[model samples]
Target: MKGIIGKKIGMTSVFDPGGKQIACTIIEAGPCVVTQVKTEATDGYNALQIAYGDKKEKHTIAAEKNHFVKANTAAKKFVKEFRNYSEEKNIGDTITVDIFAEGEKVDVVGITKGKGFQGVVKRHGFSGVGEGSHGQHDRQRAPGSIGGSSYPSRVFKGMRMAGRMGTDRVKVKGLKIVKVFADKNYILVSGSVPGHNGSIVLIQK
Candidate 1:
């Protein structure tokens, strides 16, 4: 269970050896510094805390500033804890894009783009009842008939309806690593990842 924090750098198409075009998402991965190491004997579990991206000192609180100072690293914007890392690395160690190799299967976790206040037609894919004919002209995209007539009249819980869409913590599994550009700190993964451009993502293997 080795992973790194990265930024979504957008998507592009790459030509494979078979001359077929493969769509890939570009991510600017690591140079992540280990901020802390938790052991089972002390923290009741084993995990590594890694931090990525540069953050201003003014934006950091006093406790976090002291924590980063103890780790001997500058303030970072994103910090995540990963359990069952492949190797035992000490705090203050740096992990880079070189940790990933081309043609490896990995899982990417990220937040999806937010679509505020969506309708049931677009959000839940509800095909409205009643046709356009017979005086039903304007009810084409409406969510028809929510509750029953008499018994249990209130709307049922967990009913899919119109509301906010996207902006969810989504995990995409089994995405292949198409390329690794360690020199530039960029890695390309096959298929799409969650979130918009410049959003943070976690890649796990």
Candidate 2:
């Protein structure tokens, strides 16, 4: 899979050719630098290690600084390895949003926004325990009857009780590219994507 790193730039609606309004996510796709190239005979796997987003020189360690120096690129904040990337790219090569074309289907990978601690109703879509009327009291949001009494005794594994929510690694596939701005390094894709504004995302084809 060939891909590029990008920053989420929120979403907006655009009019299509037939005057239909389509909601799309705007992303600031890379101009990523090829920091390293792994070969089968050398690293036991084929991959391209790319880097994106600038970082301060003072914040970079000596080893990483030397690595970027060898690639002729500045310190990058986000570094990722793309396995089995088919493009014939070498170290110091620059990849931009031009690699993707309009109307092409791609997959986007990102981290979802965190929702912190939550209950069963909001987390697992469980209907709250009936109503508070008829002496039901505060049991409305409770997770009812988690056990089988003397049969199972204990709560079963994989129960959908609430704990933490969100901040998960998510992949949204089959997203069509609505538009591409190569000069500005932006690509608009149809439909929603994971992550908040300015979060790092991977667009793979």
Candidate 3:
């Protein structure tokens, strides 16, 4: 697998060759530094630990400082490990957006935007109980009956109910790479990515 840590730069529309307007998410990917190179003999697995985004030295701890020092790079805000990396990259090496190309398919992993507390209508797309005419006061967004009267009287586990929503780690797969701008370290993906604008995301192929 080949991967890079990136920041979502928001969305935009571009015109394709056939004159079709394509909506895509702009991501500032890579120019990441490889912090560690784990091998099967030493770490019992092969993975490349890369770091991206600048972080303040004052906020960095002693151990983290030492780790970044070994990579000969400054402290980074995001770090990710890609197992079975296809390329042979050594410690302190740099990975850039050039690893990906236009029309290539990749997967993006990011945290969805936190919607805070939500109801079943927005959370699970549950249509609220009918019209509010028949003595229905706040039943518009209610979850209705939760459980049965008897028998399995308790509410069953994994029941879809209104609660905390979003802010979950989600992986969107098979998203096509619409364009790549190596000069700007940006890649336009052919779909919407998770998280809000400027959020960190991991692009993997």
Q: Relative to the true structure, how large is the alpha-carbon lDDT of every model?
A: 0.94, 0.95, 0.95
Q: In model 1, which runs have C-alpha deviations exceeding 4 angstroms?
A: none
Q: Rank the candidates by lDDT, best first.
A: 2, 3, 1
TM-score of each: 0.98, 0.96, 0.96
Residues 1-205, candidate 1, lDDT per residue (tens digit)?
9999999999999999899999999999998999999999999999999999999999999999999998999999999999978888998999999888989999999999999999999999898776899888789889988889796879999998999999999999999999999998999999999999999999999
* Displacement of the residue 122 alpha carbon in candidate 3, Å: 1.0
lDDT of 1 at 123: 97
lDDT tens readout by residue for model 3, 61-91: 9999999999999999999999999999999
**Best first by TM-score, ranked:** 1, 2, 3
Q: Can you tell me which runs of candidate 3 are displaced by over 4 Å?
A: none
Error of 3 at 136 (Å): 2.8
Model 3 poorest ten-residue lDDT run: 134-143
Task: Return the lDDT, model 3, position 10.
Answer: 99
Clashes of 3: 0
Off by over 4 Å in 2: none
